[model samples]
Target: MNLNPDQITNYANTFIKVLIDYSPKLISAFIILFAGLYIIRLINRFIRSIMVKRNLDPTLTRFLADILLWVLRVVLFVSFISKLGIETSSFVAILGAMGLAVGLSLQGSLSNFAGGMLIILFKPFQVGNTIEAQGVTGTVCEIQIFVTKLITANNQTIFIPNGSLSNGNIINYSLQNFRRADLTIAISYETDIKKVKEIITAVLANNPKVLKIPAAEVSVKNLTDSAIQLAVRPWATNEDFWGVYADTLENCKQAFDAQGIVIQPYVRESSKSSS
Candidate 1:
């Protein structure tokens, strides 16, 4: 409180001396921090270039590059802090604790993220693939980190969480180059079974989209009290699957009607007589 001039001057000199001694370290730290940032950017670009060369999934590549960039930046920050004589162990510990807290609070989101990674890695289905999963059938429009967008045949868009999509049963109709259209038409038992089979065979053969090498099949699938179900399986390219399916059904109906074949509900002959 009552310092002499000598004491004040001594204190001032000591302060100046400390600043001079630490100036080099401060300058060095700034240089290192800036240089490290530039290096991190370079590393990020390098990794991205490699990903592109490998023809990696675009989503995965983007996600990985972002992760790498952030991780390296964090390390660079910690290194800069340590150069300033700061205790980095405590900083790291605090970061770890914060990460754990955030992870616990966002467990569902983290799960979805992990699920997305799995999907990208395993490729259960990709964008534009027609798939059926979780009771929803659609063409996959987008495979994002948290959700997958599907465009249904009715032109409705559905967003399915990746967490469920990764774990659910996925049927990818687009995976195969060719698909078999299993068309079952129920005909009245009064119709001649042999004649019905002949008509179905002819219909399949007439369809240009249907593949002939595998040969289409028309056989009795089940016999009910009132009707016999004929299983008409025709192979066609995936692109023509829907076209062949719809056309085949229409053709079968026309052929049957022309030949006087009838389709009926499941009613027993005895019940019909009683009515």
Candidate 2:
């Protein structure tokens, strides 16, 4: 119980030395943890502030913000562990292995997510627009990271994967200010070409929905063994596409019949069959 002065001094020095040696490690770990959590909060605030200030779309902004926050969290966690004297190589290897397994299992989901990202970035189509994609035609109702929702003219809801949507061709009818209504009518060669053209033009002129600025054109596009093919193209708003298409075809037939312009068979028979 009675220690010499030198022994007491030695004990104090030893304790101070241990504290000094471990202080840096403890401080470093604390800083790393604090920085990681702080960074998450800061990044989230930054995203929200910027997005609200700019009035960006809520869905897109939230999606991007979530991704950014997760990335920051992972990076900060790694840094924090490294400060705690954990070997990063082994941790990294484990993370890589798990990521690979999850990635493989979610291959389709990943593809869809990537496709959705492209769609948001490129904006090939938007909600409430009529679009034809993946051999299906409908109005786009919603676009999500996993799928695209479409509502058909008949009010049918269809879900299409983002991958199929991005990879396949899409015909967006709503992007353009105007759309063309094309009708093909074939007439017998013996019928007066001049008369047929006149009848078709008259029908287009009578249609109030047709736009005159673009100047509709009616011309003989081809002459087949059975008939003379005429391509009548008229300009109209995209909303009126189906309406104008239906009207033009019906009107052309009525008008041409009254003017004695004959129509040819849709499919021609062989000469031997006819004989």
Candidate 3:
């Protein structure tokens, strides 16, 4: 089929009219797009500097900055499309629906991610810190987006989901400069209570790891049928807690042996009757 000259002229006029009507909007959209991108970069840089000044974790800072960048880009894209005379309400609604679906499918993972954000923000525990959480005691090795890695004393690597870890009780042993070591020593009921306390106190004082300012405490915690439970409390630097605890126990035992302090064994009443 061949078009008439009139038909060709009509088509050219229509094309020019459309271009004339849309050129301003197209130029504006391009300008806004570039300007928005520059502004987003500035905002991201400002935020990163703030996070750095506040001493936030590097990994967390990068993750948050990337997220913000993408969100801003998405908003800019929507505006650009709207300026091009395209309907955007349906587009936004579609995006919202897709987000809801994805969020629901990844509910647990999203929860863990949120928890990780909270942990990084609040810093209840950090990498290399010894913490007891979720019934596990270990040094935190890594903090990730959804989980925390811990290395136990026995060289086991444990992965704890951040959701529960953030919500549960956390005992950070390394947070404080000093830690108190509580030890229990049992002695025969016939032993001298005053002498026992004096011996334990001397043992703690002699240990270099024990702190002198707060002083050590040794007192009868409980009395059983055969023995008295003595609570030996000592303050030591966090790094020296285990050393002080072990040395104190061993030193106290040696002192007791030298002083002829016998530790009574528990004999059950039923066993005594049978014998």
> TM-scores of the models, in the given order?
0.88, 0.73, 0.79
Q: Which candidate number maximizes lDDT?
A: 3
Error of 1 at 154 (Å): 2.6
Question: Which tens-of-lDDT digit does each residue in 1-275 have in candidate 1?
Answer: 89999999999999999999988888888999999999999999999999999999888899899999999999889989988888999999999999999999999999999999999999988888999999999999888899999999999999999998898889999988999988888887677889889998998888899999788888889987667888989999989989999999899889878988776656545634555
lDDT (10s digit) by residue, model 2, range 1-275: 89999999999999999989978987988898897788789879898889989977655787888888888888888887788778999999999999999999999999999999888878899878899999889998899888999998899999999998999999999989899877788888788888788888888999998899898999999988888899999999987877888999999888877776667878756667554
lDDT of 2 at 111: 97
Q: After superposition, how far is residue 198 of candidate 1 from its true place, in Å?
A: 0.9
lDDT of 1: 0.90
Using TM-score as the yardstick, the better of models 1 and 3 is: 1
Q: Which stretches of candidate 3 lie above 4 Å from their native place?
A: 1-39, 57-60, 83-85, 265-275
Predicted structure 2, TM vs. truth:
0.73
In model 2, the runs with Cα more than 4 Å from the true position are 1-46, 55-58, 72-93, 270-275
Better of 1 and 2 by TM-score: 1
Candidate 2 achieves a global lDDT of 0.88
